[model samples]
Target: MGSDNSTLSSDVITLNHGVQQYFIPSCEKNRKIKIIATPNPSKGLVNINFENWDDIELSLSVFDALGKLILNTKLNTRNTQLNLSDLSSGIYIISIDNHCGGASSFKLILNSN
Candidate 1:
């Protein structure tokens, strides 16, 4: 049996057998936006907080389990409240995107009792 030697670079991998694999690394390492949501399993109302978001234009969107758009709006403050009481109990996705190329998402659970 022969030995296998491989090398890896910042964005590529090379095998001793003359094979190369290339890939692009994610650029989100320097993302300046952070978010947190409270009362995950909420009945209808939820509060969200933002961090490191100084004068950054960000947009918030909420989508249901079926990939339907539940809410979409621009965030104008570091803290905001969302009224989901009208929505049914289920798992939803909250996504925030910074027009400057940063984006993040969170999973929210709604419970009806």
Candidate 2:
């Protein structure tokens, strides 16, 4: 048997055979929202920036290396600052969600000293 496939759009794909199958790529929309965290190894203070935000409601979350949630808050601006001076020095995971269909995660290092 032979099969053929075609892309319906940048976000969708279709396959043709005796039976038709549709496949949708994951995270296509999420990729559009660019996230940036400055000073990977920071001294308790960090700056976060977003691109293509389009004024969509977004939330910021921080988790410890052990998978414990350290912080969670709704973002009110395209650029925001995070204060992690209270936390110990180590690696942390920073996550951002647009609350629509886009989400991203980043790694942040905090140096208490």
Per lDDT, the best of the predicted structures is 1
Q: Report lDDT per candidate.
A: 0.70, 0.67
| Candidate 2 residue pairs in clash (backbone atoms < 3 Å) | none
Tens digits of per-residue lDDT, candidate 1, 24-62, equal 112345444546577777888888776666655578899
Q: What value does the lDDT take at residue 30 in candidate 1?
A: 48
Per-candidate TM-scores read 0.70, 0.70
Candidate 1: segments with Cα more than 4 A from true spot: 1-31
Q: What are the per-residue Cα lDDT tens digits for candidate 2 across 52-113?
A: 55676677789999999989999868798899989999999887776565556757778899
Steric collisions counted per model: 0, 0
